[model samples]
Target: MECVFCHIVRGEAAAHLVYEDRAVVAFLDARPLFEGHVLVVPREHLPTLTDLPPQLLGPYYAVVRRLAGAVQTAMGAEGSFVAANNRVSQSVPHFHTHVVPRRRKDGLRGFFWPRGRYPDAARAAEVARRVREVVSADGAG
Candidate 1:
């Protein structure tokens, strides 16, 4: 079976994509912790962050950094939470960085997982577009 994220990266699966380039692709999380939550992944099918090639690290994280700012701005968030899991807690085996929009007292607490979904596909697409706009304007896309 092919990795779902690899499918997304290859345009073989549907995703609310916010950013894409030769090295990485970013899209909205189907199950998000908050509105505008995005997942950044490499084009290659690396299983974990540690598995990412050293040459790709700078380029990969550069996109993550850009998306972190764009997601916060697009969501009108006070800040953003960026995280990654190794093999232990990774829902998908493919490597990814979660960029979650955050606000003061938004009910997320340390080490506690709370997940939510967009009310509809239209809503999710709108959120992705907003993030994409910011990323494009910032010259990160």
Candidate 2:
């Protein structure tokens, strides 16, 4: 219950949710390296990538693939940076994949750690909802 991403998935906490399905939820990162940086997370609170169930792997990656394209296309970025953390640098206890929008020499150098906050919760939720709409129609997660 203390896991923040879990609360977000349940709508118990505010998040910029862009995509959802049976297995996964994708949302805007509260503090991001770029405006459209998104977090694709599993619905079940798996603590790390190695903790993921084998049955859920396909569905999860499908959602991530969809969101990667959405982040680039929707945010008008030339490319995308898709990555995840295990125990190290894992901000939340739950597992998550980062789908960040990228441009050439956009000052996102190094470990891609620069972060920024949303101007307001409404804006964050709005962006997340919009992303959700795009990824939802692609197929079932």
Candidate 3:
């Protein structure tokens, strides 16, 4: 109940709010990757992507898409990075998409680089099954 984003949505805390509507709110990130980095959050306090209702996805992503373009245009960057992290690296407990302006060699790294792999097909299938269970149980499969 003490989520920072929840406080922002309720206007209990100060935020440089840039956009808001019936479904979502967007604001400048206090700690940004760059000056124009923004966090677009749904008004409802869904903890992560899996918790977001399917019907709201379009509206949520519409804001993300708009923010991506706006961040790049407003910051005069060559491109933008639009991303979300779930429980692993999500600093806040609520769902939010990061729209960050980008330029060549701007120092953010690893999206294009290769990552560590699973040991083999059987091991991979086991992992896939685990993920599939969550998605399928949620009626998303």
The most accurate candidate by lDDT is 1
Best-fitting candidate, scored by TM-score: 3
Per-residue alpha-carbon lDDT of model 1 for 18-128, expressed as tens digits?
999999999999999999999999999999987898899999999999999999999999999999999998999999999999999999886467768999999999999
Q: What digit string (tens of lDDT, one per residue) describes model 2 on residues 31-139?
A: 9989899999999999999899889999999999999998999999999999999998898989999999999999867565777899999999999998888788765
Candidate 3 TM-score over all chains jointly: 0.84
The residue pairs in collision within model 2 are 16-128, 17-128, 18-131, 18-132, 19-132
> lDDT tens string, model 3, 1-141?
599999999999999999999999999999998998999999999999988988999999988998899889999999999889999889998999999999999998847457898999999999999999999997879
Badly placed stretches (over 4 Å) of model 1 are 113-141
Q: How well does model 2 score by local distance difference test? A: 0.91
* Candidate 2 C-alpha error for residue 87, in Å: 0.6
lDDT of 2 at 56: 94
Candidate 3: where is the Cα deviation over 4 Å?
112-114, 118-138
> What TM-score does structure 2 among the candidates reach?
0.77
Off by over 4 Å in 2: 110-141
- TM-score list, all predictions: 0.78, 0.77, 0.84
What do the candidate models score in CA lDDT, each in turn? 0.95, 0.91, 0.93
